[model samples]
Target: MGNTDKFEMIANIYDTPERIQIAKVSSDAIRECLVDAKSKNAIDFGCGTGLVGMNLLNDFKSILFLDTSQNMINQIKQKISSSNIQNAATLCFDFEKDSLSDLHADYIFMAQVLLHINDVELVLSRLYEVLKESGHLLIVDFDKNEKIVSDMVHNGFDQIELTEIMTKIGYRDIQSKTFYTGSKIFMGHDASLFILDSQK
Candidate 1:
């Protein structure tokens, strides 16, 4: 199955109580990452079901929620509309190929989605192009030190590898932290959060 198909399948199962708890943990980490940012213009890349966007409402004045799956975007739209989150916009577009249309954001967030991309470096480059000077890019995904499961399609890199890639792409002050100490059977690994700011 393709990425979108796999995502769609998961979306059906993601609404369970346990999954909602995990999503809350992820969203909390994302909220902590944006606490220091002064800019209000932000983009939540791969914003599945609007979890990240919902948590980010206080930090950012406006948010553009971009995701590859139309289903995912629809889910986010539903949540936003029902909750009256007026400062957000949902876009169904592939992050790799879509043009940013002269938009420069102060912060770009990609949580739990970087590993699924085929080319990490290229994705970083694309994100960098649309980021304003000294903009921060917060990436939260599975750390390589964590064990892999059979169902997971894409594998993640270690902190060193991720930091190297960010540095090579002209990002500075790269910092990483592991959020969850314990692991569950289904998740297969403890998740990590990486925070990096673009160099001026």
Candidate 2:
């Protein structure tokens, strides 16, 4: 199966305890980076089942959950309906094949999503375009790990290289730090997750 298909298959039960715990941390990280996001429009780019975004509804008044998988979008819709989450919305979107020219966000949160993307620079450039001036982009993903290699996913990333890419993409004040580590998280080996905060 492709990346979208594989995630779609797991949409129903994607919120495992470990994943939820990770999302909570990511939410907190975003909250810290964008302290006043409640007054801003937030986009949960590459959102999967709304775990990270939903947890952030209180912090961000309007949350747009965007994902490439329809099944993941369906699950987000279900969660919004069941929880009576009026401020949250879902969209089956893929920036790689769609346009974000009409939309802009003050805060863009991406958690555990970049490793699956093959063209990191292209994706970041699109995300930069979708952000409003002075907007904050929060990214939570695995740091470089040789033990977690995969054909369908990345082995993780180097923080310095990622920062350089963000700089080249016109983002200023870039910062990246590893905030979480877990065993058997990335391809059955211990992995550390880094949070990158960049200002547009």
Q: Which one wins on lDDT?
A: 2
TM-scores, each model vs. reference: 0.85, 0.96
Q: Tens digit of lDDT per residue, candidate 1, span 1-200?
A: 12776776676455666556656777677677665554478898887776766777778888998888888888888888888888889888885766666778888887677767876888888888888887788887766643564444455568788889889988887877777544552355554444433442
Note the residue pairs that clash in candidate 1.
none
At residue 37, what lDDT does model 2 achieve?
Answer: 71
Q: How many residue pairs collide in each prediction?
A: 0, 0
Q: Identify the leading candidate in terms of TM-score.
A: 2
**Candidate 2 lDDT over residue span 3-68, tens digit each:** 998998999988899888888888887778876776888999999988889888988779999999
Against the hidden true structure, what lDDT does model 2 obtain? 0.88
